[model samples]
Target: MDSAVGRCREIRLRAYPDGMIQPSDLTIIETALPEAGPNDLVVRNRWFRISISTRLMANPDAQAVEGIPFPALRPGDRLADGAIGEVMACPPGSGFEIGTFVSHPLGWRDYAVVDAGSCVALGRGPIEPAAYLGHGWTAYAALTRGIRIRRGDTVFVSSGAGAIGSMAGQIARRLGASRVIGSTSTPDKADWMTAELGYDAAILRNRGSIADQLKAAAPDGVDVFVDMVGGEQLAAAAEAAREGARFVLLGALTAELNVAGASIVAPVQLDSFQLILKDVTLRGYSADRDSAEAFPEWIAWQREARLHFACSTVAGLENAPGALHDACEGRLRGLVMVEV
Candidate 1:
């Protein structure tokens, strides 16, 4: 008999109505690996964890109507940062080897049994697998397809020290931007952007009206805006835009507020006038769409040195909560991972 069973843990979010998510909003439960059916591969589950966007709860008024192809929660499932694991066993006729390292779109669990087709093999490489979490597709999507950023353009990026933003700035520089101006909250991050990443300049976002500051910094005005903080930032980007700029809208960290009504939950609103007049293009991106092109492109970028990546290391399933707390509190930067 299988002794007892291989045990794994999962986090389930309670019904949170106010967009509130704390460590207590998560419930940790022990569960056993699913018995693999046909063509199933049971991974020993090495490293896996969550990102902040996936961990936050949403009220219906502010809830996204839908997300990408990631499966929705069942009766017992939850939304959290995902992880990578190693294949320890495979059912007969499954083509996977037992020792392959793979990443799947499952939550913070110790062991996972997934179909062979559901994962991407972590080939022997210099790039860390977890770096592929947000850093991989995100930077590629922003520059290549999302913004169509060109050489000799001026690019303005928000949250410039973050996982996606930092890589995006570097890619812009390599892709031949004449100048890359980034906005960060502190002098320390601004200095890091300029000195370490080869950025042309960085403005301290907390110091002044970002719109006026960016306008003052870019006498020619911005040609591309890779925006993460919406509301005032978006409004500012729109105002500071030169003729024919491409504004790639990626996030809304400043959008959500607990307004009394559905329409008012977010203070961020976009005016179509500037986009129409200045020949400015606004577009939103999700990585899963057209990943068929992105994956190979990403592999090439990393190989060619245009893309640099990093991740925060964690160990074991027991530390999931603490790791998540660290991520939330800004103690760790880049994508967070558990080494198992």
Candidate 2:
């Protein structure tokens, strides 16, 4: 153990958020570090991810979100998620050396005492600590395994400027899609998607009917739909889907983050006729299941600079709550991370 190490600061849920998360809903507290067990490693977290899933987990009433293995948080409980950290203390024979950077599940804190089995060593490389927190694997799995982006397919991703959606657009293009389109809340974000994220077109959800905008963007109809922000987007994508199209259901940000007291079962209206007449195949999968296979491929893409990591970074642990709030509210683009 480092002689200078002592107590650590962590963010905890102050209350279950009603709808939009506020900074006041979380509090930072100091506590003594836990004693390291024989198989445990103490780490100093460098960066922690702030995501919509974190927002969903903060809701005590929200049901267990699919694909997230962690339990829902209660008042005074520490917020936990993907984090990159340097090992400070580890038991002999733990196979992890001090100063090794590792990715773990304990986050929203300055330090963590995690099981050795849960930590994945990130060798010193050109990849930054924050890059390890990117949702590239999620996007990779959704594109490759969820539906398999076919050559010449026109793909539409909802919330294209989002953490996963941003990566989805680029990956879809790399997977041989002829045209990639994305829908975002603002024109600025839509422009960001088309200009920077390799999208052929961007649809502004705020400008007019999403269906109308999508129709104009893909007049030939979308061959693949990556539905992230459900509700209106899901309905619109269904309407604009081409014959024999594939729909990959990812997240439901609009209903989950916006509507107060909305359950995971929030109703998504889609035309049943479109599904049958167009022979559209809608599929949803847990990212966790595909991560094992997707991580290696995603890493290869990163090393080759074939993928772009769009990220918004906040400098302090104290600001994690507000960063998360921004992420949930669609103010931040791509993966939002906090430097702890």
Candidate 3:
């Protein structure tokens, strides 16, 4: 294996106190690349994905992000989250030889030296980095494995224009759902959901009470609820559920609201008696858990399903901070990928 290496560029969080992700919060620095030791491999990142969850990691409050423990951000810390790259160097006798494509939770950089145990070897599938992250595997897994979506079910998805919501809506359709409804913040997104994404109905959640809007959209009652925004949206979904409905809580973008002055509130209040009467099965899910356990199975299923996803890409490592900023402000639509 080639051991020759030089300097590389990476981003680090300055200080995550509060508010949205500022360009000032991230610093891009050039530093000498560390050589791979035994059981270590060096990767040249090709692409990386930005997620809203990163905002929580940046400025987390104990009261806001309960149960999810992440180390406090400080300057000079390597900001590695999720990255896909090719092995540039590997120790002799290591199974992760050079040129191998792999995915790891070490992003925000052009190069990384990671322990072999920390990376997941990726196959030569035709999957793009954007599709790999944006395809809503978590949403699909939650619907299939967590909710057990039945054929002809009426499905409702919140935040339908976003990555997971878009995927979940289409996947529900592919799974034989009779009706797929989605809620979005804008009319354009709502139109896209119904026109391009094959959703049966789209509700403008930002204009009306989520519960009232859901009632108008799914007048017959929703059999499956895939929630992205928590609080009132969740409460509204629960209110609109039919008997024996399944609720998969994927994200609560409203959960922490942002690390600043926002206090963590139960996006919505659920009455135990109403839940009991409706026979709703509510569960929270993270796609990473399924990926860690059954990634191979996921790949096979994805191939069999032949699912398609949409994404927007930004080139160059220097533009990543701006891309992340766009994501935080809800400017970028679909998956925002940085080509490193």
Count of backbone clashes for each model? 3, 0, 6
The lDDT for every candidate, in the order shown, is 0.67, 0.84, 0.75
RMSD for all candidates, in order, please.
3.5, 1.7, 2.7
Off by more than 4 A, model 2: none
Better of 1 and 2 by lDDT: 2
TM-score of 1: 0.85
- Candidate 1, residues 1-340: lDDT per residue as tens digits? 1226766666665444334344655567777667777877777666675565543333333334343343333324565445566777777666566777777776477677777887777743343664556565676677888879877999988877766677778878877789998877778777877877667888876587887888877878889998866777778878878889998877655532212311222356566787788999988765556444677677666767745564677776667767765665555645677766
Give the per-residue lDDT of model 2 (tens digit) for 1-340: 2347678888899998877888999999988878878899999898888877767777777556557666788898888989998888888987888987889999899999999999998865444654478877787888878887889999999988988888889888888999999988888887888889999999887688999998898999999999887888899989988999999988887766764743466478888987999999999866776456677676777666567788899999999989988887789998899987
lDDT of 3 at 334: 66
Clashing pairs in 2: none
By TM-score rank, best first, the candidates go 2, 3, 1
Candidate with top TM-score is: 2
Tell me which residue pairs clash in candidate 3: 80-107, 81-105, 81-107, 231-267, 231-268, 232-267
Measured by lDDT, the strongest candidate is 2
